[model samples]
Target chain A: MADMIQIEHLKKCFGDLCAVNDLSFRVKEGELFAFLGVNGAGKSTTINIICGQLKKDGGNVKICETDLDKEPDLIKRSLGVVFQGSVLDKDLTVKDNLESRAALYGIHGTKFKERLSELARLLDFEDLLRRPVGKLSGGQKRRIDIARALLHKPKILILDEPTTGLDPQTRTLLWGVVEKLRKQENLTVFLTTHYMEEAADADFVIILDHGKIAAEGTPLTLKNTYTGDFITLYGVSEDDIKKLGKPYERIRDAFRVSVPDTHAATELIIKNPDMFRDYEITKGKMDDVFLAVTGKSIGITGGEQ
Target chain B: MNELFALTKRNTKLYFKDKGMFFSSLITPVILLVLYSTFLKKVYDDSFRSALLAAGADISDSVLNGCVGGQLVSSLLAVSCVTVAFCSNLLMIKDKTSGAIHDLTITPVRFGVLGFSYYLSTLFSTLIVSFCAALVSLLYLAVVGWYLTAADVALLILDVFLLTMFGTALSSCINFFLTTDGQASAVGTIVSAGYGFICGAYMPISNFGNGLKNVLSFLPGTYGTSLLRNHFLRGTFAEMKNQGFPNEVVEAIRESVDCNLEFFGTKVEIGAMYLIICASILLLIGIYITMNIIAGKKRK
Candidate 1:
């Protein structure tokens, strides 16, 4: 696929502190791209620069084959951004909030009505249209915010920690909307999230630490490079576990052994059938990949600990 | 242009929908008018009637009282226009804090267009409130047998429009410096409290000492009050002119009630006053636009 967004040597600083430094990345068309990082890792800074909300100190950014610095308004028109903050006015009703944003985009009259109704149907908030935004639940508000951003039918959607405060069920439903939009419109999604599971499903994932790219690859590839396979055995005694010269955990009568690959993990469990009454093998997780790359857990800094 | 209009419409809808905002822009002014008519009317009538009688112009009680009421009503018009327009700047601050300004900036709407739309919205809302206040005063004037011709009403509208434009522009320029809640509240309180005094709405400018009056000459409300008073009391002043009163006495009463603003010991002619109001609005817009552009360049 063609690249939808391209950044070259992007750098931003605030006084003595560098917010984004010597970073570069490309988001392909119709790709579900994930930007993963701890707090202050420059995900939002980079997003702001691309969205034309903040000026960059140094960099060249091209969105949809147009230079961002030269034609920022043109580029902004093609990009829809839903930042963590709820930009919708709480005092205005759901429909009024959307209508206000629509007016800014120059979508009014029958066209605004049409687009609003379509979004209402898609987000399943038709009944909540007349209700004030402040009265809505967090999940409902998030959905409305997304609907507001997408009203202009932007080709690339930027979501910054969109599902942070959402419930698990709402998160699933929101992602379902994203998936449907992607398949139907071939939308390019650039998402920043702390949820490793959410990043795990992206077509491309990039991890940032201290304003630089620490890891960049597909979820499966990163997992393979950074994570280890594991085997768990039930009804295994300490003496029987000690027979193996590998690290093992004793939980009641069960033992878990870590290995390099699935073959090695399964081979160990098969070789110890008499020691294990029952056994299971499992693959590594995405957070393991994140830990390997950033050397810190999500949202936890070295100084914080 | 269409985008600006749409944004203006949106703000209008929001302003009208909010009951609290309606009261601030409309009801408060009407209530002030009622208080002015009932409580302040007698005091002003007694003082001004005695002053006119002392000026050697034998005037009927009702006509002399009309002059006082007209002056007070016009001064109220100017002060309320400025106060309500300042209140309208709250919408811009709300947009900023709510992050909707960022939301709009990310679209094709430039800051100039957005700012212009906000000003237009403020202008429209101020006019609505000012109109209500004018109606209350005009209705009272009618009860006292002091009626306005249609041309006089037209002149009154023109005066209100210019006053509102000046008020909106001045408020927009000053509000650029307000960011925090403390700053906004402080500015709001100061404008609400000081505008009336400075504009001679609470007390006639003739009562001010030379030093204080000289300082007030720079405030827009002073000129705005003078302009509005001239239009609103045009008929009453004309009647004074036709009653065979000497030109000196008519001018004296006009000066006493702030129907004419003074500059360097000279009365500002109506044409010059209009020019000053228009010129001030233009200068403020120039400053506001240039300020935004510099701020934009700094960001870029």
Candidate 2:
């Protein structure tokens, strides 16, 4: 896939504080890329800069090979954004809100109606179109927000924590819609989320911490490279776990070590099962790998240790 | 232009959704008019009647009569105050709170277009409220036997439009200074109240001395109330000329009033230049603040 979004040495600062420090990344065309970060991470800031809602202190961003600074209007025309907070006018019915947004892009005539109907059918929003947004449930409102963003048939879709406040069932429903968009329209998606499950499905993921990219790779590559299969560990206290030495790692408050295969771990377990009382020998999941690489637990307190 | 129309429609829909705002704008003017009318009636009967009697020649009947026109002016003032305080401040706050402004900023739309659309919506809402107040006042005047003319009606509509623009501009300025909705509304109320008193919204400018009168003439509301009074009570533009109120003094007042009214009319040729300037300044400040927010969010 061609490079859809490219950021090189992007830096943003406020006074003495550096919000995004020398950030660089590239999102491929037709790829569902996940930007995973804790609260207060630079995810939203980076998204804002890409969307031209903000001016960067120094750096470059390009969309579809077009420089954001040089042709902001052209770039903006190619992108759609669903902000973290609700952006719908509460007093307006879902249909009216969508129609107003359509009008903003100057979409009109029979084509506009076709687009509206298409989005309504795809998002299952037809039933709720006449309902006032204020009266809709949180999940319904989110669907409407998504529909509004997709009204103009943008080449790229940026969802900023789109399912943060949604229930699990609703989140699953939204994820399905996202998947459909990716497959059906070949839309490039750059989504920010704290949900590991959400990021797991992305083609690529960028883990951010404290205004910097902590790690970046596909989910499987990141896990395989940063973590290992399994090994039983013994003789480690809460304080001693930190002192357990090289190659051995900690996962979820327990000391762990990776071995070549299950037989090796079993032989070790057979020898000293009591040594692994608080510890467990198992295949490393993405969460453990993320923690191992970033020195912090995924979805934990600001993704900190 | 299409974008602006869409924005205007969206804003109008939002305004209609807030039932509390709609009701407050509708009923508050009537209550204020009634209260002020009652108070003026008591004062006229108790003190003004004896004073008129002392001046001689059967002034009792006229003295006993209520100042329905003054009540109308008071109602208009009340409605203007509420509209300015509620509409502009809330609109600004909603943009920030709801994150809609951020969405618009990221779009292809220019800030100028967005600001103009908001001002247009505010102007429209204020016009509707002012028309409703004027209709109620006209009913009262009819009952009390006060004559009105077509030119007077045109003058009244123009007066409301000018005041609404001024109020929208003032509120936009306040919104830029204050970050929160509560602070914006509080500051807007105090500012509007101060202007209300100075602009002779509650009293006759003629009672004040020359220095104060000159200061009052500089106020936007002063021009609005004068134009409105010229229509509803003083009769026609030609009649105003024949009243013998001193051409020089009247001309001075007219010139000063004309400055405020004409600032949005022929002199400016924009219909909303002052408002546009105020919005531009405030919008620039707001953009700066938003940039800071983005920077702050990034560093964390």
Candidate 3:
């Protein structure tokens, strides 16, 4: 796949503090690439720089091989951005907002009408067009924002935590819309999300931590490299589980012994049948991989116990 | 360009929909006109009128005519000043609080376009408010048998246009200076009030001492009121050349008056220039700030 976006040694600093430090990444064409990070991680900032809402301190950003600094208009023309907030005008009806955005990209007349109709169908915005945007629910507003961003028919769509604050049902609906767009338009999607499950759907994930990429690879590869397969150990009390240090892994309330294969699990179970009777073994999930790489567990309530 | 226009139109509609703002902008002038007319009738009694007449004052014609014109000009200036100070600040704050500015920044639209669109909307709002106020005052004057020529009406409209432009420019500049919405509105109110008092929007500059008159005369509103007074009351642009003062003081008044016109014209020019310079500067600053925040995000 061709490189849709290329970033080289990008850096941004505020006074004495560095916000994005020496960051480099490439988003391939026709790929749903996930940028994963915790809250306050620079995901939105990166999107801002890419969309020309913000500027980098030192770096070269290229869209389809056109340098952003040299040709921001050309680059922006081919890029669509859905910010964390719903950017729709509250006073205007949804249709007006969409029409205005379409006109911004110089889309009009028959071409605009066609795109509007197509977006309305795809995003389920048909019934909501005449209504004032301020009256819409949060989910509907987000959908309108997505529609507005895509009206220009951008080559690359940048969604900055697009599903944040949404209910699970809405998130699922949005995901379906995104997936459909990817398939129908061959669009390259650059999405930022803290939700591991959402990241799982991406072809590649870049886990960001503290202004740097902590790990980057296909989700499966990163999991395999950073974590281990399962080896269940029974007859271990809570205290015993805590004492079983080095190689033994405790994910949530379950204790697992890392094993190279099923044979190792079976041998361990046979050695302590009574202890293993109540235990079940499974492959390492993305949560375990996240814990192993960051030395922290997914959904851990507080500091380490 | 089309997008900007669409945005402007939407904002203009919003301005009209705001009942409190609409009333203050359009109705406040008429209310002031009524109040001032009643007050003048009581103060300018027969004794004072005869005294002024004995002193070579044209009490029979110019006093009544000028007083009518004065009240109209004062009410219009007050309305425009208040409307610009409050409405423009509110709009800017709304954009910031609602994330509209962030949304605009990310779009392919340039910052210059966004700022220009905002100014255009403000200009439109001022014109509407000013016209409504002038129409009301004209009706009141006609009922009282104070007639005006076509030239007077034309000049009055022109002066209102200049005032609207001045107000729009000041509002844009205020938005640029203030960051938060609350702070912007608060500061705008204080500044507007101070300027209104200093420019003698409610009183004649002639009532002030020499030192104060010198200072107040430099205000754009002062020149605007003088030009307006000359047109609506005296019915000639040349009437503005001399403000009924002694020869030595007349030069000082002219100098200060000239400064205000030059300053008002400069504001219009700056407003146009700000479409480029202010937008670019703010955009750059916003980018720099956001970039660092993003960098911080990468660390976590």
Candidate 4:
């Protein structure tokens, strides 16, 4: 796949504090990529610099192989951004906000109508266009924001913490919409999220810590490398498990043993058949990989599923 | 560009749709008009007529008092328009609060579109308020037999438009300097209270002299007040003349009330005043743009 976005030697500082430090990364085309970080990890700063909302101190940024410094307006034209906060004019009706945003992008007439229709179908917000954005639910407002960004049919979409404050059902629904867009339109989505489970759905994940990339890989690979699978045996005696010499921790009524892979899980289950009545194998979670790489736990942990 | 127009349209819609703001802009001007009609007009007219009578001019009480009262009341209306226009600039704090401005800055739209659209919307709101005030004053003048010719009426409208544009430009500059909605509101109050007194909108500039009058002459808003008074009161001057009042005495009153602005000890031509006003508006706009560029470079 072609590199849709490339950044090298990026640096940003605010007074004495460095916000982003010599960051380097590439976002491949037609892929859902997730950027993970704790607070103040420079995720939004990098995004802002790329979008030309803020000037960078030192860096080379390219969008689809076009140097961002040479063709900033061109890069902006090819990208759609749903910023961290609500960008919609809450006092204006959803339709009015969309129409105005479309006009700013020079999208009009038949093309605008067609795009609005398609977005209405895709986002399931056809009936709520006339309502004021301030009166809408959080999920509904987010949908309008996404629909507004998609009006220009951008080649790349950047959603910065798009589902940060939404309900679980709404987050799932939004992810579903994004998945559909990824499959149907081959949209290159670059998103920042604290939800490790949400990052698991991405084609690639990069965890940032202290203005630098801490880890980067496919989600499954990162999970397998950083996190261990757990084999929990119910109704097992701690002394009976001592013979195997595998490290064990008694969790509630079960004796839990951590293993490197599923092969170890199968071997342990067969050997411990008499030692335990029932056994369960649990896959590793993404946060374990995040915690292992960053060494700092994130505070945003409500409804992360 | 189409983007500029679109943003202007959106801002205008958001402003007028705000019921609290729309009605709030009207309240002070309407109350001022009511006070002028019922209570203040007679006192001003009687005082001016008695002074004229004491001078042995023997001018008709109706004509002389009408001239004085009409000029004062309409000047109030024009100044009130500017005050409301100043209030309207507070609408921008919403954009910053909602983070809509951040969304706008990232787009492919030209920088001029983002800034000028705001100025244009402010211009629209100021014009609407001032124009309505002018119409009400015109209607009152006509009822009192101080009718203006069609050309004079057109000139009056032009003055209102220009005054409001000046107000819009000044208010836009002020709005850009403020970061919080509370600051904008405080600015609105400060302008409402302080600007009128200095610009000769609340009182005749002739009441002050020496350095104070000279200082007032340099303010851009002082030009707007002078423009509005000259346009709205020209008919009153003609009415007093037609009533067979002595030319010199009526001229003296016009000069005292500042029917024209003086620059560096010379009477400024109406055309020159317009040019100065236009230049000032453009200069302020240039400053606003420059500030935005500087801030966008240095800060978020």
Root-mean-square deviation per candidate: 2.8, 7.0, 7.1, 2.7
Which pairs of residues collide in candidate 2? Answer: A19-B298, A19-B299
Q: A149-266, model 1: which lDDT tens digit per residue?
A: 8999999999999888789988998999999999999999999987888899999999998889999999988887888887788766778778877787776657888788887876
What does candidate 3's lDDT look like per residue over B187-295, in tens digits? Answer: 7567555655565555556666667766653555566555555555543223322435344432433332221223322432323332333343355445433543453
Candidate 2 lDDT tens digits, A1-305: 89999999999887887878999999998898999776656887899889887789998999999998778878878898988877878888888888877877778668788998999898888999888898999998898988988888899999988987789888888889888888888999998876777777889989887779988999877766776676545557646444433356655645667665556667765665556565556666667756776677756334454
Q: Candidate 1: give the clashing pairs.
A: none
Q: In model 4, where do residues sit more than 4 Å from their true spots?
A: A242-253, A260-273, A301-305, B59-61, B145-147, B289-300
> Who is ahead in lDDT, 2 or 3?
2
Could you report the DockQ of all the candidates, in the order they appear?
Answer: 0.54, 0.36, 0.30, 0.60
Indicate the worst ten consecutive residues by lDDT in candidate 3 chain B.
Answer: B256-265
lDDT of 4 by residue, A1-305 (tens): 99999999999999988889989999998999999888788898999888888888898999988898888888988788887767888889988898888998888778888888899998999999899999999999889988977888888999998998899888888889888887788889999987778898899999887788899999889988888888888876777778768877989888888888888878876876677568888777888888788887665642222
Q: Considering DockQ, which of the candidate structures 3 and 4 is the better prediction for this target?
A: 4
Encode model 1's per-residue lDDT on B1-300: one tens digit a residue: 788887887777767776776776665576668878788888888887787678767887667767877877887787888887887666777677777778877887777777777788888888888777778778877777584689888888888888888888988888876766567667877887888898888887888999988888877668778877877777887887887878898888787778878886987888888888889999998887677667665555
lDDT of each: 0.82, 0.67, 0.66, 0.80
- Candidate 1 Cα RMSD after full superposition onto the native fold (Å): 2.8
Q: Quick one: best lDDT, which candidate? A: 1
TM-score of each: 0.92, 0.80, 0.80, 0.93
Please tell me which model should have the higher lDDT, number 1 or number 2.
Answer: 1
Interface RMSD of 3: 5.5
Winner on lDDT between 1 and 3 is 1
Could you tell me the lDDT of residue A146 within candidate 1?
95
